[model samples]
Target: MSRYVALGSSMAAGPGIRPSAPGAPFGSGRSARNYAHLVAERLNLDLVDVTFSGATTAHVLHERQRSARPQIEALDGSEELVTITIGGNDVGYVPLLMAASLPAIARRLLAGRVRELFDRAARERALDDVADALRGVGTAVRGRAPQARVVFVDYLTLLPAEGAPAAPLSVEHADLGRFVCARLEDVTAAAAQATGCELVRAGHASRGHDGWSADPWAVAAGLPLPWRPAPFHPNAAGMRAVADLILEQVGKN
Candidate 1:
């Protein structure tokens, strides 16, 4: 049996997948059907999934959620595989991106004045902080699990690519959404490269399968899933897609 460690935020945790983790510190939401679970089961690996909803890179490094220790506690020298999907929460990108797509706010996206509403400089600085934190996480995980094959799985796509039918979002909202998500991928990519971690290009792998497509791995902004909290986030299919991505990169049959 191979030892595998999984860590990261809700993207890796799959909050809405069903039958949440048994001891998740009261409100640290989790799911047993997350991509980690799917991948571990498919590969027949010993899984130590400590993924949590809303977890930041800091949480994985040292911070704790209530009674739960850091996510690093789940890993040990014997691990053969490790996967992490974090950093988005460090900049609070998900909620901000979802809010940006709201009708009340998105309706004003076409206006140039939208840029004047928020502190763009502050937001950029926050993203910079995320970049720094991600590098630290990559480095620390490597130090702790030196023998483990570390795969830094990036976040999945939320909106369509540049040119596509914007069924779920207004044209302007779709553009803004893609831009935000693209930058997020760029940040993660840079961190992955800097840390010598294997980068699983989820943004590229999930291209046409965005929320706007006929068959979406992720849900559209306004379309809420029966189980998930937000209208945005990955569905069951999305989790499976990520699992497949790992398999592809790992040369697994």
Candidate 2:
């Protein structure tokens, strides 16, 4: 059987929104039916889920450097496959994006003084530091698993419902969100290229869908919870979608 490795944050961790029962597949927040598990099951491969809730690229690096256990340790020899989905929590921007509207936030940005808000938050929140850390991660992965096929997953665009009551977001906010994603894509792609890794455009899969839309792989509010243990994780359907993507990529490789 092929050995596969997965790395990233809450999305990878399966923090379901619904409450988790004891000994459940996933604890609280998202569900255990995240994309990784889905892919693993489809491939019938042994999977090492090296993901943590609220993990940042920097955190990934720090943990690898400090651990010796298989789950927490750095990659050793090259494997058949490896996937990473990180960087959302680096700046802690997801919460802001989810809570506020871009149009309302953009007004503040155009005021010239608003740039400070972004810069301050990026600096204080460790967003600005992610690029270098990601590069380092790429280098490390390559060094340890030189022959393994590495894949990096990107974030998707997030939009609120049409005319939904939401926190004010200025046009600038929306633009900035797009801008941030673009930069992230560029940086992550660069890292993947440098490490000989493939870039999996996970975000593209979410296009044309808002957070509230029924996502086979995503557990959001108002949806009937799937896993009894991990309510926020993906249901079986969601897992299938993720599995399909991975299987497709693996076949290509």
Candidate 3:
């Protein structure tokens, strides 16, 4: 079997998704059934999955996260495939959604702090930086594994395109979250185009499968029960969907 590598943040790691992947670093939260694992199994590839919960592009390309090395350190010219799902944490997308899910009194107390962390202008600047960083990641992967087929997998949609705000998130917060997600998707697409890597439009494919939808792919705000997936993160169904998408994309190439 050819080698395959998975890299990126929590969205790719599949935290709280039951049955952690073997050899996953402590606190990485990598799931055995995450999309990368699913794709690797379907394609019969030797998978090197280094995705981790809460990783940013900096961690993927350069910096260390938790006790693990930089994600790209797992890659080499022997790989046949690589998938990336990052940049959400860099712009505070889910973090802002989590803040918005806070209790009313807590929201009031933390509103200023949250805004300071996710101000619109600041997020815009960060998106630009994320775009550049994503390009850097693609370039680095090409240099290390020239034969690898790289795919940029964007985050799944968390809100409906047009609908009333879901529980635990006000209209304003929901709107802001949507805006951030859309911008992140755009940035990811642009980077993929610039880097000549394949793009899996997970965010676009997940439009009607928002957290509040009947067949939700993402988890809405809820209690942090051990059995439950992380709030605002992709669920099992979403991972399967994304794995299918990647399979289709790879098949075409």
Off by over 4 Å in 2: 17-30, 64-74, 98-128, 160-172, 212-240
TM-score of each: 0.86, 0.70, 0.96
Candidate 1 ranges with C-alpha deviation above 4 Å: 22-25, 103-119, 163-173, 223-230
Shift of residue 229 alpha carbon in model 1, Å: 6.9
lDDT of 3 at 82: 90
lDDT of 1 by residue, 60-165 (tens): 9899876778998888788888998998787656765555555665637544434432335555777788888888988998999998888999988877778786
Which rank order by TM-score, best down to worst?
A: 3, 1, 2
Arrange candidates, best lDDT first: 3, 1, 2
For residues 1-253, write the lDDT of model 3, one tens digit per residue: 8999999888999888988999889988799999999998999999999999899988988899879989899987899999999999988888888888889898688878787655778878888888888888878877888888989999999987746767778787788888889899998999888887889999999988988899998988876566767889989999999999999999995
Whole-structure CA lDDT of model 2: 0.58
lDDT of 1: 0.78
